[model samples]
Target: MVVGLREVAERAGVSVRTASNVANDFPHVAPETRRRVQAAIEELKYRPNTAARQLRRGRTEVISLVVPEISSPYFSELAAITVRVAAERGWTVHIDQTDGDADQERRMILGPAGRSVDGVLCSPWAVSPAELVELAAGPVVLLGERETDGVLDHVAIDNVRASREATLHLLARGDRVIGAIGAQPHLQNGTAELRVEGYRQALESAGLPFRTDLVMPVRSLHRPDGAAAVTRLLEVEPRVDAVFCFSDELALGALRTLLEQGRRVPQDVAVVGFDDIEDGRYSTPTLTTIAPDKTQIVRVALDRLAARIAGQTGSGAEAPLDLVVPHRLLIRESTTSVRTRKG
Candidate 1:
């Protein structure tokens, strides 16, 4: 037997509208009435018809979070945070994975999947700013670095700054001939490009020549891709002293490869990574990484999306917001307290 709003209203000795106001968290409800309605709801285990309520209120009470790959630890953790934050605000979240396909991402942005939700939070890798503008489905807040043309809400850290800091840390430890792994030159993603630019900037600042051979490109930011890139890096530049990976997943794979090849971490080669994922913390050597404030990112993105959903933008009165969350470089065993040798 399903308990409905009418039962709750009768038990609370209030009208249907009053019970609804309490259930929906309307500000006009009195404290005494709210207490009675809440007590009745608990006693009867009343579950509101969310779909119907949303329809009547002209909202869906649902948000969509789109990422490149749900299996990736960074993306999965982000999605989990998004779901938790949305739930706290009495909203539901739907997750979509695009597998880093441009057409698929475009479809997700413009197709039915994007239209079904009240708003969308996306971390697009392949979709361009022009494409987003032309095919926008609804209210959107981006989670990663993308050129949004000042029209879409974006929340991300300064990828270039963080990457530069990571590389400079490696350089400060007396490591030269540092190989950069996980460059996605083919994708032309802003994240990859920014990270690479940062790495080059650090090298340039340090008076180190940027060698094309030391930069290893990968098709995906996956474990196997990282391992393969590292393998090639070792094969060509066998004396490379350190590597700065663009992601923790890649760093883990690179660490594994180094271990398999009988190379001592931070002794023969130092390693650093971005996107301080959990796996990085527990890895054998404990990865040093750029840790973005994920909590703040989720909070800001949700707050902005909620505002947009409430029609707060108000007829193009305000410019779209681009929030750059703070990040820090965590120095772990992977790149600390080790003697550096010139390779």
Candidate 2:
């Protein structure tokens, strides 16, 4: 005894075709008719069969969101938002983690499992520009990464701008000789290169000499990597008073190392980090960092994906939305003023 579309149409006193048109948002349907159909649908609680609808429409009504890693708060929060937004739009969301490995990334994009989803929203690492171009064969939205050759729609914060702002925040606090713990150097894609460029820009703007030794590049942007990077930075620049970690995970590790070394945060060394996560807020002395509007990122990304799934390629939803979410520096107790005695 389940209510179906026909029952809804009968309850609304409209033909099945009219009810279908209303549900589909066809412009030809009158507003009163549309409202009536909606009211009937509400009254009947007639949930549309998603599988049937997809099969009829030849769409999966599913979007794949692939990330490099999810343990990081940034990716975890992003995934939550993406799932929420997709659910709101009545689309299913699937997650894939590639561990930032090149082969894994390519397989996710080109392999059979990838075809199960209607469209893809990817934050790829180790994916070359050429591979990205090929992956554009399917409807794809790039997030948290740079677009290669403008082949696909992308939504991202301006990494260079965010990085430059973070650096300037430290400089404004009267800290020179800023050290950076970031991902690998000469990376072809992703946020690392953009952040490095921004770091250089900040130094150049302040007439501070950029030292190659201070840019301690690491293989991963994980917490352990951050700890290792901090050790290297201090070794390279013994008098470094401030550091800008490209990620919060790395910054957390850096803080741990500093604490173990008997250095007081902000009192001995000030550290700034990107992607202001919860750990940053509760960490000892707290962490100063940059935060992006994750809510906006997920909403826009899901909307773009939904539009693509519905086969409304050009005008309905896919409108070439290359957006950059705004970011701000969140100054906390971590970076106050350096008061370390040169040993």
Candidate 3:
């Protein structure tokens, strides 16, 4: 015979309401009553119907995480971490990719997918703040630097500061003609813009002229894009001593191109990258990079989403929460040596 809540409650000598409260982990039940209910539940091997419980509470216990590209190591790794974290909290995670298209991103933000999920966690690449505010009808926690007018929960690293520090590290190593290999001038909320601004800041502070030609603009931060950008950099500024790519994917591509041209890494041209993906570590010449705290990002984003799902929020008048995680510059063999002569 099947064990039910009523039988368990009767066995524990408690009212059905009290037994239900104990089963749901409600905080107000007396200690002895909780113990009795738990004992009865264990003895009977009672199992609550999760779907029924969720239906009663009007919650799906599901969340959606949307990113620009799932194929990218950074986004893929983030998805893995999010899945693990969501499982621990008894919630299911759904992954979505937008391919960095404005229309697709907007649809994912405001369409049926957004409606079905209990909440959303998104690293929006092309969605505008106005579009989001007008269309978004669910709880959302932004993953990157999307300008949301301080009206939504956001989690990100200090992109400007981290990029500036990465540039300064290259400068400190005596790389005078440092070329930046990722610039997306089209996107308003582009991370590349912030990174380039930091690169400029570091150049100006170091009394080095910021060469517009050295700022290689790419359509995307993919490996092919990186390879093409580096090819252009080599053609225009053959004497460039160091290159800082906006992402490891780009850096990996740049590395391959440099090798094909018989250029020695750190000897002919030092290389640095952002987003320390695992590929960076195992590459022929390990890449130096800005390593964002992925674990902390996952933790904070999930925690904020969980709070939102549970209907927890600050006073209506309070500003939306923006959490900035920390980052570190990992110096590796790619930028190990200081070149006396320019490439």
Candidate 4:
């Protein structure tokens, strides 16, 4: 009961090769012939074998999206956008999670990707900077805060700027003694380091001295890590009035711990987070966060990848090697309107 390409061709009164060209969307078929084939396909309810079609073109039309953890809300939403966008262009996205493992990232970068996929979109955590240029010589584009050496095709917001903005928001709302959570001093990850730098910059600009006691290091950006780090922070710095978390997950966790410990959000301890995830919108006080434009990130990434696949590196149409997308600070109830106006 299956309607195959051969049947579709017969119904359209065209050769199988002609029908195939149409199905694969290869150019050069006469206009009338294309209409006939499309109509025949519709009438016969023909479904093309995508894999076989792509293989004939000497391409798989598949891309790998590598990330530290897809389970994270930020990454989950990003992967969803990537998959949806890739499908519109007749491509498939294979999501590969490394759990921030260096060895896994190394293997993925140096392993079967070249043979299996047309390109790669990665948000790397543990890969060394030296390996970044090598990653770019292939069709690899990074998705997050990484020191790409201007050689790799990278896409990310300015992490330092975003973090500074988040901190300044809390400060503007009359909250001082802010604790910074999610500093990964133990890892080679540039994201946490950049965020901490931004937090420090904001404090410095506010005439607040950088305090080592207020900067909390975390093993991960998960809720539990946030909960534990904030707990320890609260125990030591009982007067901490605000916290700028590196991720919404951490912020949510910190929010929970603060409320449980008798601190009211905004009134007592304002919270700001990055990665404006959906949960933030529905949290108790609703979270304030830095929202990166995920759809734009995926579109730009895929566009760059397509250019790379076509060997369009030197073409003037190619985008910048290090592209920065747009992000906005979304304010919510978690941060009250400036409790005290600042100059």
For model 2, how does the per-residue alpha-carbon lDDT over 1-343 read when each residue is reduced to its tens digit?
7877899999999998888888788899888888999999998998877667767876776778888887778899999888888888777788888888877777776652354678888887788655775855467877877645556667888899999999998899888889999857645566888888899999999999888889989888888999999998888887888989999989999999988887778877889998988899988778999898888888777767666656645555444557777778899988874434557
Superposed model 2: Cα runs more than 4 Å off: 1-53, 112-115, 310-321, 337-343
lDDT against true structure, model 3: 0.87
In the range 114-134, model 1's lDDT, one tens digit per residue, is 546788888888877656757
Superposed model 4: Cα runs more than 4 Å off: 1-19, 22-52, 135-137, 312-320, 337-343
The stretch of ten residues in a row with the least summed lDDT in candidate 3 is 311-320
lDDT of 3 at 22: 94
Model 1 stretches astray by more than 4 angstroms: 1-45, 111-115, 338-343
Query: Which one wins by TM-score: 2 or 3?
Result: 3
Cα displacement (Å) at residue 100, model 1 = 1.7
lDDT scores in order: 0.87, 0.81, 0.87, 0.86
Deviation (Å) of 337 in candidate 1: 3.1
- Cα deviation in Å at residue 112, candidate 2? 6.2
**What are the C-alpha RMSDs, in order, of all predicted structures?**
3.9, 5.4, 4.5, 4.6
- Pairs with steric clashes in candidate 2: none
Cα-lDDT of candidate 2: 0.81
Better of 3 and 4 by lDDT: 3
